[model samples]
Target: MDDLRRIDLNLLLTLHALLAEQHVTRAARRLHKSQPAISHALAQLREIFKDPLLTRRGAAMALTPRAQDLQRPLEAALNQLTSLLREGAFDPHQAIRHFRVAMSDYAAHLVLPTLVKRLRDQAPGIDIAVCQASREAMLAQLGDGEIDMALGVFPDTPSNIWVETLFQEHFISVADKRSLPLRGKLSLAQWLARPHVLVATRPDADNEIDSALAAQGLHRHIALVLPHWSASTKVLTDTDLILTVASRTLDPVLHGQELMQFTPPFKLPRFPFQQAWHIRRDSDPAHHWFRSTVMDCSRTSPQSGEKQAVSR
Candidate 1:
C-alpha cells in the first residue's frame, strides 16, 4: 500500500506509452505530451522502480528486461482501470453480457417472446437466462445476487428490494371447449361445479381465486395442481378441468387449441404483475434499460382493464 501511494498513476500511463512506443518522441506523440515531459516521466518511473525501464539500443530505444516483464501486466491493469472508470456507460448493442432472471412461466409467456425478439435485433450479443423459483426463493435469490431480477406478483417486498409494476393483469378462466363448451361469461355455479387445474408456485399459497371463492362460502375442487403455467392450456385440451389464470399466460398458448376463454364468474381484483430487484441495482444503467424494455414489451399486449406501468 505504501509503495502504491508513493507511485504516481499518471506516470504509469506515461511508462506504458513509453514501453509500447520504445521511443520518447513517439511516446510523447501517443500521449499528446511534449518529448521532454515524457522523458521526465520516464526518469521518475526509473527512480520509483529502481531500474532503468528504457535504454537506448543503437539507433532506436529498447525495453529493459524489467520493462518487458511489466508490459502485459501493466496493460491488463490499465484496461481494468479503464473499464472500472467507465462502469456507468453500458452499451447494450456491443456488450456481451449474461443476465439471470427469476420468473414464473406465466411471466415468461408474457415478456420473453418480445424480450427475446428485441434482444435478437437490437443486442445480438446479450443473453438472458430464465429460472423459476417460489416467491420466497425468488426474494432470497435477489438479495443474494443469484439472479439479476424477478418477474411476478411481489406483494410483500423487503425494504432492501425495489418493485416496479410491468402491467396490471386480471384472471381469464379457460376450459376445454369439447368438454365444457362454455362461451363468453361463465356462471358462478357452472365454474364451481367443474374440476379445476390450480397453478400455484407454492403448495400452501392462497391465491386470489380461492380467496374470492371463500368469500362467497363456496370452494371449487382442484383436481390437479401444477407449478408451471406453460402447459396449463394444453392440460385442459382433453379434460374437463378449467383454469383461471392471468390473461397474458393464455395469450401465446391458446392458438389452435380447443379452449374457450371467458370472464370469471366472480370479480377478481386485478393484480400488478411486477419485476423486482435488489435496491443495490436500482441505479444500474443496464438494469434500468432492461426493466424499461420489459415494461415496454408488456405494454404491447395491453389488457382491457389493466393500468399503465408504474415504477416505485
Candidate 2:
C-alpha cells in the first residue's frame, strides 16, 4: 500500500498511452511528451512490473505476453478513473461512447427518431442500442449496467434508481379516416361497438384501457391482438378496427396512412413517460447529457412539470 501510494499517477497515464500505441515515438506523440520521457516511463513501468511490456519485433514494437494480458484490464481501469475524474464536463462532439437503452416499442417510436437526429447533428461518434424489455427486466438491466437508461412508464421504482418524467401520455383511439365517423370525441359505447385492435406485447401485461374498461364492467370486442405497434397500421388502414394507442405513438405508427385520432370517452389516467437510470450513474457526465437530451426531445409541453433530482 505504501509503494502504491508512492507511485506517480502520471505514470499510469503514460503507461496507458504506451500500451495503446506500442511504439515509443507514437506514444510520445499521443502523450505530447518527448521520446526520451516516454522511454524513461516505459523503463520504469518495466522495472515495476518486472516485465518488458513492449518488445521489438523486426521494425515494429509488439506487446509482450504480460503486456497483452494487461491490455484490457488496464484500459478499463484507466477509463473508469477518467470517467470518475471528469464527472461534470463532457464534450459531446469528440466523445466516443455506446449508450445502451431499454425501452418499449412505443417509447422507441416516440423518442428514438428525434433522438437519433439530434445525436447525429451534435455527437457524431456516439452510438445507441435500443432494447425491448419489461419493466422488471429493464430495471434489472439498469442495475447490472446491461442498459444505460430506460424510457417508459415505470411505477414504484426501487430506491436505488433515479427517475425523471419526460412527459405524460394519454390513450387515444385511432382509426382509418375513411372508415370511421370521427367528429370530435369518441364515446365509450361507440368505442365498444367498433372492432378494436389491442396492442399487447406480453400476455400478462396489464393494459390501462383494459383496466379502465374492467372497472366499469365494460369490455371491447378485440378483433385482433398484435405484439407490435407497426402491425396495427395495416390492419387499421384496411379494416374497420379502431386501435387505442398512446398519443405520442400515433404520428410514427401512422406515418403515411390516413388515420383519425380522438380522445377516449372515459377518463383513463395519464401515465408518466419517464427516463430512469441506476443511482450509480447519477453524476456521470455522459449519462446526464443523455437524460437531458431525451427529456428535451420527448417533452410535449413546457407546462409538463420536471421532477426534482433524487440520488440515493
What's the TM-score of each model vs. the native?
Answer: 0.65, 0.65
Could you say which candidate leads in lDDT? 1
lDDT of 1 by residue, 1-312 (tens): 988999889998888777656778867886899998998998899998889988888997778889877876786687677667868588889878788999888888777889999999888888999999988899889866688999888777754567877777788888877765434456789788889999987667778889888988989999888897887788888788889998877754463367888788888999988888864455456776788778888775554322222323
lDDT of each: 0.79, 0.78
Cα shift from native, residue 62, model 2 (Å)? 48
* Global fold similarity of model 1 (TM-score): 0.65
Clashes of each: 0, 0
lDDT of 1 at 38: 91
Give the least accurate 10-residue stretch of model 1, judged by summed lDDT.
Answer: 303-312
Off by over 4 Å in 2: 1-88, 182-186, 252-257, 303-312
